[model samples]
Target: MRQEKKSEKQEEKNKECLADLHTTDPRDDKERIKQTKGGLLEDSSNWILKHDDFRRWRNNDEARLL
Candidate 1:
């Protein structure tokens, strides 16, 4: 009976962990561009890019590069 109780507690903990793992907050590209100087293309093979935000960021520190 004690072992069954412990197993049930472990199952509850696992369910909570799985819920946390699957949860994510939606974020958009514009917000990301403003927050981060650089952006990435969706295609895996696509090249890294620098946008207007990157230019602004680079302007602040010339040493920063894409």
Candidate 2:
């Protein structure tokens, strides 16, 4: 009874948290993809190049090294 109601509230809270986690800001996704794919490989590669850890490894670098 009371336990069931509490569980339901907890479930709703969890759902809201999950929804928040899943919702992507469009700009963030675009930046993520730009950083991911080697498409940022150019003289103007600001975002990807700025991320030191990400820039340290490429597809080939990962395969051959780490």
Candidate 3:
């Protein structure tokens, strides 16, 4: 779908732009994504997990994603 292709292109662009970025902290990536991409599609939250679970994964790297 077009959305998938756009996401892939944006991801590739971000990778190239940030290849020189070196930091264990994920704050930079999160900030960069917030700037470059639209916040979230309407109703997209329902496509994945519940809001609380999503928040957990967003904050905790050790959390399992399914």
Candidate 4:
């Protein structure tokens, strides 16, 4: 029916909108570092200071092991 076709089109449009919402453009590595590592530093300066590459370190797993 015509109503069924219109509903299908609306559903496709809604899916396209949701797909665009889900994709994130790649962010600058430094900015991600600043946000996450800086937050950690702000929270606990002494803990992060022990690591030489604290600014660039991504995973806290190694730090946790230490």
Using TM-score as the measure, which candidate wins? 1
Ranking by TM-score: 1, 2, 4, 3
What are the C-alpha RMSDs, in order, of all predicted structures? 11.4, 8.8, 15.5, 8.9
Candidate 2 per-residue C-alpha lDDT over 1-66 given as tens digits, one digit per residue, 9 for 90 to 100 = 999999999999999999988967899887989888845556675777678676566544656654
- The digit string of per-residue lDDT tens for model 4 on 1-66 reads 999999999999999999988855466655787787773344455767667688446455666665
Per-residue lDDT over 1-66 for candidate 1, one digit per residue giving the tens place of the 0 to 100 score: 999999999999999999988845456646667579666556754323456665676577665654
- Candidate 1 runs further than 4 Å off: 25-53, 56-66
Cα miss at 5, model 4 (Å)?
A: 0.3
- Backbone clash numbers for all candidates listed: 0, 0, 0, 0
Per-residue lDDT of model 3, residues 33-65, tens digit only: 778895545786675666776777778966645
Task: Judge candidate 1 against the unseen true structure and give its global Cα lDDT, from 0 to 1.
Answer: 0.71
Best by lDDT: 2
Error of 1 at 43 (Å): 29
Q: Answer with 2 or 3, whichever has the higher lDDT.
A: 2
In Å, residue 5's CA in model 1 sits off its true spot by 0.1
lDDT of candidate model 2 versus the reference: 0.78
| Backbone clashes in model 2, listed as residue pairs | none
